[model samples]
Target: MRLRLLLCVLCWLGTTPALAAENSRVLTTIKPLQQIAAAVMKDIDTPALLMEPGASPHSYALRPSDRRALAEAERIYWIGPELELFLQDLLERQDSAVDLLHLPQMAVRKQQQAHNFQKDEHASHAHGHEHDHGSLDAHIWLSPDNAKVVARYMAEDLASVYPQHVDQLQANLAVFERSLTALDDRLQVRLSPLRDKPYFVFHDGYGYFEDHYGVKPQGIFSLSHEVQPGARHVNQLRQQLQAAGPSCVFTEPQFTPRLVNSLTQGLPVTVGVLDPLGSAIDVGPKGYEHMLEDMSGALADCLEAL
Candidate 1:
């Protein structure tokens, strides 16, 4: 009887990997972070995503459902207040939240001021909030290397929460790292042909990717992610667009293309869509890689046409 009981106990222990992790109700503010966390927590848990697809984090108003999710979440992961300005004070109230922006070894790109980028739309918004990024560009996840760092940091965090799944989490992170290397090599080979090919972006959110891959844009229409350029700024952008002739102009899915189209009309420019936030991408292990691949494809396709 004792021997039979010992065998049953061992079988139950072995089956624990298939069970839900302890305190696994993880929540992430954006799709990319959710994707990263999902990859790290593979086989153990799937983090609940807060921001809906096609929603702009910069301008997203929290719904009742989102508020409920926040209330119930055991742990939360987000970039920081700089990118998701809407989540600043709310996150301060959540003790379980982890701000990945301040993670060790993060390479934050400071916002480079264009003489044309004088007006910050957030400073003069309809909402009476003044959001100064402290000149920090919060689009850090666009860098593939940054994605790896995020996964590493995320794995470390998850390991603490679910110590029972530590081995699986570490294994998931290793798989993520190896897969990232393969994706980086492929992106380099694919985007290598379009080096120095000038392009224009509707929003200045691709600085991290551009800097990482050496495919910088020629000019930007707006400095803020969620605002349209004013008439004065539009005029300046038009002059700049006219100067950057025979190039490609990229528009984002989250914002309207009306301004971009108007500026590029009658100019030797091809308009292309670049989804910086990967709003259309489904949350999964390959979400980050797919976002970079999609952006690189859009760039190469548009630039090659010009």
Candidate 2:
């Protein structure tokens, strides 16, 4: 079931949001989302990025300056409370913000990754992410299909708000669709071989990508990023890793704690980097594709070496 947005971002293209269209500044919560909004608002005005690249939404804290960004922008977009816990209260105090997670067309992933290795086990201890039970996974922007839905939503809403820029926004959406199609095809072929390759992640934030590309990890080190796994649990994970032999362990760029290095030490595993937020990629019309391509490349490069 789709949870309602506190301010009903569901009606972003409605009359209320369209009240002020002239020079309305748009803001997006993260880099991936900023990239998509940029694509739709291409050449009109670039949407400001709220969370910088390489920052984990799970741990981000909203600042007074960020509040100024929120107040200044006419439209703000973000994944809902499940992911960006810090932004929930702030959004409740305002109406200009829209929760992309609440979009009706969104393809929400209720549970974590659908991995065969985790069916019988309680990976809840050391899984990728431990969202509240039955809560939606807020990484909705990772899937290309979902990306299309977002791009269209942005176009439709922006067109309604700024009727003068309708043609340009529609054209931009057309180009974005074409580019996403090509990216999706290439990813299908690129990640095809590595789907069955056993792997693990420091965070289970990659469910959308994994499910979309058919790449499932063996298991994860910890489910809650905020909690430290006990020595007993760590040893059990190490034993499981030793049994698997030469697989890869992917770590996110934002949080590469010393615990990760200690967990994989002396094991027959290659520790690789996977930046979910695409910290190094430039935010632009093609930024989303570059980010995903880099992620796929990182996975393929690390897994193939083993």
Candidate 3:
């Protein structure tokens, strides 16, 4: 009986590393997606992020290391051809690539055009970057409802890859849903008072959050981050701010153009920073909640100050 027990223990130790190796093959395109993937994979395995914290998905050029990571990844999650145009061609060829935007469960919103905002026809000459605004906004992760959908799909996808961890993944998904529900309840209470507060975002990317929380923005300075706001657009935003009265103008961490200061100058507007990518927040199971909380705080701080 002692010899039989010793043989069984040795066999179990031999296969443990193989199981761990299988579980660590997941990859996500951005920090927000990584946050959801990490939550679904809590304690089982951590997914790798394709884009670095400060990198702009609007105009990212894939590095050689990124290519290698893509080649080695067992499964890749991205928003699709709209947001990450750079990866569209390459991902199209990869069978393991999964476009989250294309998922039927995801609730998508159309990108809103800037009001009285004309396209910067000479933007390419000045900025040297092209902008392609897809009909749908790819920043769906901003909405907590969308995050729940993403987490469910991630759990399902990971379960298929590592069936041995299916039970754990399902438990993680349950925890995520519960936590999201609690967070949403708390946020609704906190943001309820600020619903009528009018503000302006530098980019039109926060429509999902604004719509979900009933936070209204007077207007957007630019539709695309890659394209700098032209003189005409800046003047138009200034006019809106003047007409709308004292309001806040929020800029993103990734692209706080110098024009923001110029546009808000001599006006009763305060500048606030909103980071959609959660660049400053640590990446982990609770990162997504932290990101949303930070955004809400940023909005409340500036809008309430007025």
Best by TM-score: 3
Candidate 1 local lDDT, 129-244, one digit each (tens):
23344577777888888999999888887777898999999999999899989988988887887888888775557878988888877765543334555667666676877877
Going through the candidates in order, what is the number of backbone clashes in each? Answer: 0, 2, 0
Query: What's the residue-level lDDT of 158 in candidate 1?
Result: 79
What C-alpha RMSD separates each model from the true structure?
10.1, 10.1, 9.3
Ordering by TM-score: 3, 2, 1
lDDT per prediction?
0.75, 0.77, 0.81
* Ranking 2 against 3 by TM-score, winner: 3
- Which stretches of model 2 miss by more than 4 angstroms? 1-24, 113-130, 223-228
Model 1's lDDT to the true fold? 0.75
Q: What tens digits encode model 2's per-residue C-alpha lDDT throughout 68-159?
A: 77888888888888878788888967788888888999888875543323322334533334556556878887888898999999998877
Q: How do all models score by TM-score?
A: 0.83, 0.83, 0.85
CA shift of 259, model 2, Å: 1.8
Runs in model 3 lying further than 4 Å from the true structure: 1-24, 118-134, 223-233
Superposition TM-score, candidate 2 onto the true structure: 0.83
